[model samples]
Target: QRATNVGYTALRASMSAAEWLTSEKSVEITVATTTLDGEGQGADCALKIHRLKQPAKAQRASLTGYQPYPVRRGRRVADEAPKPDPANPNSWELGEVVAQDGFNTDAAGKATRTYQLPPGPYRALLTTQDRFGKEVTALLPLTVLDPKGKTLPLKVPNLVAAPKWSLEPGEDFVALWGTGYDEGRAFIEIEHRGKLVQAFWTEPGATQQTVRQTVTEAMRGGFTVRTTMVRENRAYLTARQVGVPWSNKQLSVAWEHFVSKLEPGQKETWTAVVTGPDAKKAVTEMVAALYDKSLDAYLPHYWTGGFGVFRYDSSSLTSQFENVVKQLRHLHGNWFTDYRDAHMVYRSFPEEIMANLWGYQYFGGYPDGKAHGLLPGMAGPPGKDGAAGPRGDKGEVHDMEARVGGERSSMRAMEAPAATAATVAPVTPAQTPDLSQVSARKNLNETAFFFPHLVSDAEGKVKLEFTMPEALTQWKFLGFAHDRDLRAGLLTGDVVTAKDLMVQPNPPRFLREGDVLEFTVKVTNQSATAQKGTVRLT
Candidate 1:
């Protein structure tokens, strides 16, 4: 690039050195003039040109991905990954400072040079040339919140917490929490100045419970002391757990019949019935789940039998599995996809015929056929010497007389049933009318204070002055089913898909990016009556 005009006389030009100066490159954004239609109404349009900087648009990918690539930056185009700029931090972003055709008059009285400002809040004096000719200084704030919303106070302990402690924003001084306060739940109201703000001590959707209240939005930046004294009449401890008994029944009947007609043939057909008054409801729930906003995306990659992630062996075996194989045969041109987790239920079950009537292992003679799991008749917890139980009276010689056949089998002596019968064990028969009740109870381990997300300190002590009507069984979960949020497909990561079946019109999408992340909390009940008749559907 050459300068067009140098303001020097022709006589002095010969005296001037070959190069008087090397012009420093400085970016400037000047508004352009555009005539409005035929009206000759001119409007201002600006072009910003500067040394090409890093990419302005940033994006993130989830853990589950078809192909994973980090985001960066570039001069000509946006790179995959762009780190937060400590110097010109995205602490705040006010959109891109776009560049286009632009012009400006230079120092020697001649128009030259393009213009661009590193994407901006349009704050003045960002780009500056140092002696080294490099980007010298950039001061910018991070753009944390995207889209329009009130600035929510920073949550307690942060959003990535095990037990997310958050505050709800509302008018007035109310500062409300979305976590537990007491066992059942409790809330406190503080009179801030002359305004009423609630200090609630409860978690919403906690065990399917929602307690809403108004609270103080701001605090005095100091700790407020609180004290409460209470007395109660009781002995041991009483923690009430209300569990509804609901049956989920999936019934299938399949039979093979040989025809006596001219052509001797075999025929097999199956009828599956999901029964009970709640069957359709359950079907609706599952069908809804297939396409449910939280889960629809990941149904295809689901692993059956309660496992995480997709194993290559499963992908291989799924093709030959009875369900996939039979579906291919039965449906002919159309085939069922093995991705649905329920295919584990719909597929051909383990057949006892695989074992002969004598119950012999069928694959013992087959090469490369490894028998899986435990044998049908294996007993006593895999490997233990102990038998079922002991015999009360066994070969005893009492008073020096060995009486043969002295004992007779009683009616309760019959063989135990091969199948298990469900039994209900009550913690307490009933709360006693008469029990020692006292005030200022010093008790630890309150059920109301339990939080799965929060662990109580082993050294901490809590006081409760209450008596129990009966012995209470302490509970700490082990091998328990995962909460429904994960199992029901609310966690629709990269591999989730809606192809299995859909609960139409319900689409679950995870925020690929943004603020104010939210998820649904589904509270299922056996029937409307199960939850005080507040439940609209079973």
Candidate 2:
């Protein structure tokens, strides 16, 4: 039995060694040596070694791209590796190499290289060899911008005039006029709350251009006017309209009948209707002007008289004024008495307009002569009558009538109600919800998957089986492998496991028995074909 056991153990050991030699993914190297003893007897010594399996051939280079930084003209800018083409993510486009450098990695296998490149688009290509003698390449794209960066030469509009700062949406017209530079066409852009709301292009010229835009609800919060001089489809100059609060409000004026032509010594009555939420409380003003051909300007009708403007309080919504054309001649001589074209302008403002006026005066006026201030308050409709109050005491009412009749009244003492003991109910403390069973549905927050000792099969492939965590997210995988010979390689990738049709319920963390909640659930369909399903909540 002992002999048999020894033979069985030896045979099993030999079989295991043979399987290792044939099944293992490695190469065997053997060295044999012959030695001679003093007595001339020959002996043989054998050594066996294993080498790393042959590395796979270099199929294609793996490129790691980087985001390109904006390069400014006249400045030295560094380049980055080229990014993959959007059309073909596996390939990269080649470009001219304006700069180049060589670097050596440190103990951490990391290196940095700097290059000064000129302003233009560029691509950086890097090639490296792996431990297996396989060559891989990394590509990155680079871009250099002009020295101005996002800023262009500022070319302000010679004039940005609107008929009124406050306007009615869809009912009022806003006229904007601007002067453009000689080199390009004026591109007008209207932005409201940092968003472009309207934009248009003007005729190419170094002349004044005008556009009439109807106000819309989108412009109620005010807007900014930006003018850019575009030459050859490139913006060379740009500016924003400043010193004005271009907003809509609740105070406006409309002419009932405008009197544009007035003869000498003729008295004409001009009437305007004030309309808006605060029309009844707004202040209206009018100014008459006569155009002078010699000065090429319009002179105020009453330039030599009081204030040169008519003021009215439109408490009833209508403002009217009568002016005698001859009075202008009497005050300022024949220059105003000439047969010139006349014009009338009317404007209305809420109570807050005084504050804006004060600010304008305090700041000595703006360079653009446009007033800037807070929006005028919008007065709502008159409130409805409140409910009637309880009837007054009889004696108090009688005394009020006696006083109205001019008769002396006698004071009467009123009886007070009897006091009664108050009854109170005992208060009960709120009971905490039973949470012992609330945790029945276990929460799996541990999303990490680490297989430190994974063994690949003979074909150099690994199969992993696991139950994914209940979290909806992306998982990144990093793996490295090394053979007995110390030849190593690394790889990284991402995996996402999700249902084509999924229903995710977003419930509150905790809840009471009778609590009302707006339970919401997100349904996502990621399959190529559209599908419909019903959902029921228990």
Candidate 3:
């Protein structure tokens, strides 16, 4: 059977999620003030706020079998993806705070209201606010204690803030993290030697936010950082202190011996120019890396003529690079080598070799945008006679040597050997290693293509600005368009329309004898042209 042709067109736009009112049934919030478990003086105040989880409705696509033609429309696949909303049709967000005052807490985690009034019937309002300016309000009865017997306790807001190092390898920046309830915005203050050096405000909407700063040796002894969350009239505060050390101190302890063994010429080639006696030792080892024929290593060192640039703690960055090497060894069935030997692992271009074999020239482009194909005559490990030997299971030679332009021919020659007429046992699926996880963790391999826009300005000064894609969308032009026209879209802006299809069985999991079970298929089209296709099951 053939599929039918159905074409459609639609425009797509992304808008922020709508906010829900707090008093709706879809939103549940409980605010209570309590005292510490003590008979008299030890009694403390605390506030507990609880929110109940609400179920959401999922939009599923209808599945149809043996369609006649393909459907075409103009939209991205992501736009076609189903966006299920909450089961409650009117529900959205419930974090808008109306009014809040007089919140106090003691060391024992007890909470109380700020105002002091006579012990009698009274009403108190508790409010919760979210980053989207959505708020919910609850009214409860409050009783004031008699002044003659005991004084009423005060209320205190609970805010949390801390400091941590960034994840990027060899980075000298530290990020300050903060979170709190009803925090609309946050202000951060940094101090060194009791002098204010930095102050800034964090973005709203997120309960958590981080601000980063470069730390230097001058602020080594004591660098203090603090964040204050401001929600309406209430202010909550938290602070932390850290010590800064020279960035070069992060180099691995094994670097000195590693560089000393290299030939003087090799040392000069891989070495990064470094100052300070303590740092010189670390630079030698840090600068050791595979030479990229291209000048863009993603770091300053590409221009400085060394292995790598930028100061970093060895464990933070080197550990990740080492993990990649280990993964390569496992993939190639060369796991017998000692992990302790750095040269034995890093010097071997396993990633490049794999790319060459797969004909993936653009994959994992080096910083210099040059593809350093497989090394000449380098195949597997050394055999007894010093010739290349097989490294993979079932006598498979993992290495395939190729020159710059003869990748495909070289691969064929390596795979088809004349020496062995006997067939080797096939490797079963169970014997194969999963490279998915290895590929995911190897971000270093994608450094070049990931930051394609790293360019120098008119002043000849390089600018390392990383522009992350804000939204993932696809676009198509109906008429002819040149490169300049596409670039012009950056200013004039262009709209996108796309669609995709998904199929699922009703009652997703289990099926019962009497229960109705149905198959559903959803087709999303995002093209200007009509299409004809087939959809068949089994």
Candidate 4:
């Protein structure tokens, strides 16, 4: 029984070795093309299989002394490699097999085949099963170029986006319209982080589209919008970053204070009107805001002066105000960001306040001369092509803004108005005086300075005596009559002052990066009597 078992095991081993030997068929496969062109005469591919060795004695043989093996040919494209389908295990989801040809072997056991295929890149595979049911595959890669070499690559499109309402405010709803030229289908994607926030597709021939998205504070961290144009198998991409939104509610407060200081009639009446520079349609939209009753008039220096003054009454005032806010919301994009900054400059340049007092003064009009309108360097509306200016003109829409005020003439300057409000001056530490010495007979006290009465002799010469209150550091002397305008020097030193002021920085040393420097400015009370006043730091 043991001898019989050993003989059976040897027989089983022999059978296994025979199966392995039969499966190891020595076949050499090589692929070639009849013509270099993507398209061929009859087909694009010619594959030759040379059977150098055949299976052992038990395999079937033909009388012609040739081996005919079953062979199958197919292709798998790069893009379709990831697709999966359980129904077709042998044919996993793949790009269509572009070509196939009859497989026939010659008398010398050489099989040659041909395949018809179009121009493109593909992975060609020749698969065959050995006598023992073992699979054998031969792979060949092919990249077919255009036969005529006339096909060209797709190019990136020229793209642009602009707001429908250029002056819209930060919180308002605004639509961004985009226009460009591309050959095929286009895609617009607004992305934040690695994920897509907004996406839209355009048809093959459509070059214009609009995207409406809220201008929000959260987007301040920077989100990007991208547009892609796809043609054939290629893609072109472009991206634009969203800008920070302006939030200036304080502008209303500053504007209110400015109107309050004007003369009674002037406060209610429009002093000047500005218009033109039609190239910038959005600038005209700002005219809607000028109707607010709180504002006197809109007179930008860059614009011509013949514009009609507008004032909103109780009936349309609220609507007009809302329109102004709405327009500002539309202007929340990058194009209008500089304009917002210009508004901030208007405040401080005025009294070292916050407004561009200089610009306002320039637009305010000539105090001595008649009001004359100024035209911008460029004339007429922008071109129909949505250009900011006529062809060949390097004109920027922003240049159409009012020029700096108070710069019309070298002589005109910003001047402090005469003391009309009767406000007391502040006191500085340099000239703090004794309050007990002040006389109450003249209404002079620790907090108030009193002016003394003066009498003119027969010669029209006058002599006066008054007490300078405590904290009085400096004073200006001026001569003025009831109706005549007074002209005086502007510089503090040039004007008549009671004392010489000295300004000194503490430590008397250069400031380092994080150092906080303190300043001590001193002024003497040059008057014979003590005076009450305060010092102003800038």
User: Candidate 2: lDDT of 84?
Assistant: 47
- Separately for all candidates shown, the number of backbone clashes (residues 3 or more apart, or on different chains) is 49, 8, 48, 37
Off by over 4 Å in 4: 1-156, 164-182, 192-195, 216-222, 230-236, 244-538
lDDT of 3 by residue, 1-538 (tens): 8554332311111111112111112222223322222211212222222221223222111222122233336552333433323322122222223333444233332343333233222334454332233443444433222222221111112223222422222335545343323334667777766567888776655444545666555554446667765443444556665545433233222111112222111112111222222433211211112222233335523222222332322211111111111222334444465567455535556775565566433233335423334344434444446554433344233334534235433323223333312212344557644434322111222121122232222222222222212122321111111121111001011222112322222333544443333433444444566543433322
lDDT of 2 at 491: 40
Best by lDDT: 2
Q: Residue 495: error of model 3 in Å?
A: 76
> What is model 4's C-alpha RMSD?
39.9
Writing each residue's lDDT as its tens digit, candidate 1 over 1-538 gives: 7434332211110001111011132243222221112112122122332222323332222223223346535545455454434223222323444444423223321222333332122322233232233332223221111111222112111111111122223322212222111222323333333343334433432311222333332332211211111112111111111111111222111112211111011122211122222323112111101111222244423323222431111011111112211223454466666775554446553575543323333323113222223244432121133332121123211222223223211112334443322122222335322222422223322221211231112221111121221112221111111222222111111111111111112223532322232222343343334322111111
User: TM-score for every candidate vs. truth?
Assistant: 0.14, 0.19, 0.18, 0.19
Candidate 1: worst 10 consecutive residues by lDDT? 11-20
Instruction: Score each candidate by Cα lDDT.
Output: 0.24, 0.37, 0.33, 0.31
- Regions of model 3 farther than 4 Å from truth: 1-183, 204-208, 230-235, 246-538
Least well predicted 10-residue stretch by lDDT in candidate 2:
10-19
